[model samples]
Target: MNIFILEDDYHQQGRMENLLYQLQEKHALSVKRLEVYSKTELLLQAVQEKGSHQLFFLDIEIKGDPLRGLEAANSIRQRDSQALIVFVTTHSEFMPLTFRYQISALDYIDKPLDKENFEARVEAAVLYAQKQNRKTVADTAFSFKSKYQQFQIPYEDIYFLETSQISHHVILYTQTERIELFTSMNEVLKQESRLHKCHRSYALNPKNVVRIDKMERIAHFPNGMTCLIARTKMKETLAKMGGEIE
Candidate 1:
């Protein structure tokens, strides 16, 4: 996980930096990078560039700056959905405003900082950020795009994918919904190796397979749907499920 410190006070900056050093030694965490920025613009730019799997320590009151830390957090959330944002401020009055912004902030620290509280919050945030970082690495997602809309679907959510018979169109099946996307099955298979090509027109998730009827040459999912499986590909499908043919 990476760390970004955005405090305007020189003394607070020094204190936070020291606390971070203590955290590193205490946890023995190998943080990929650390950045300290007093300027809001620089921090925002950095967040847009490498905000994934990152943690932020933002001071609520920046002297002479109208765009305070809360605004910066709102901006960061636009670019990064999973970043851990912690607000540090002198006044406790602004604490209630966090619910209004809905930034999903991790925690808030009162200035003239308490070492124990600071350490505890930082430790919790770091653990959560690192857990999310590992999930990002392991659970790769398929990104969908169109003229105006775009979203990502995690590979594990897909029960199966098949051609729609329309040019550049495919039908995606999940337990919750079916989506029509303008894409090729080859393109999708190339993106994720976990999908098994059971037939010329279909790819299946072995983990999602509830049953396979050899006589019908079909694979079943828990959603009460079945996809044709080529007779020749049965062995490979079984192998994917860690089953040995008897």
Candidate 2:
């Protein structure tokens, strides 16, 4: 997991960093990297370069910035909506203030940060992010990380997977966004060639499909949700499905 921290208080930053490491060891986490940023621009640039960050820890205040940490957290979400964000603040007054950042934030932790609360929340977030990090192919194999128990998936169960225009993670279509696991579209495409990349953003698994209404540029799955098929790749998509390229 990669996490970027935007905190100005040197002493508090040190404490948070220590807790992060401790959490890693205690949870047996596979944290590949963690970054600390004093500037929002630096953090934003890093996130953009990293493609996606596993988690973001933003302090609700910056020493000199006019906007609060909540504002910065919101900005980060605009770049990657699925990125896990946790806002920490001494201002417990912002508890019901939750709605302001509810759309982007996964959780808000109050200061003086309690170890028990921190551990529980971070553990839950870490587990959820890990779940969001991977998915199984439709069928014929049982593959998954040992620590996780998501179960072997049958590819026929997959609806579709697509890359987001503004983010690094690809969205999975398992009929529900809840099944929307976050993995690189590249890895997914390479592993399962049956999934036709009908557009720059979408790759559809034909097995779970209902019908393609080409005139409307949409794919209707058995569950009733529709996905757009870009006109640019219409020929290739049809060819993959064994239909004549019109």
TM-score of each: 0.57, 0.58
Candidate 2 stretches greater than 4 Å from native: 49-53, 64-66, 95-98, 135-188, 192-194, 197-246
Go through the candidates in order and give each one's C-alpha lDDT. Answer: 0.76, 0.65
lDDT of 1: 0.76
Candidate 1 wrongly placed segments (more than 4 Å): 48-52, 139-246
How many residue pairs clash in all the candidates, one count each?
0, 4
Clashing pairs in 1: none
At residue 168, give the lDDT of candidate 2: 53
The collision pairs in model 2 are 138-154, 138-155, 139-154, 139-155
Model 1, residue 23: C-alpha shift (Å): 1.4
| lDDT score, candidate 1, position 31 | 74
Predicted candidate 2 versus true structure: per-residue lDDT over 70-138, tens digit per residue: 777777665444567887677667556547555457777775756788667766766766555442122
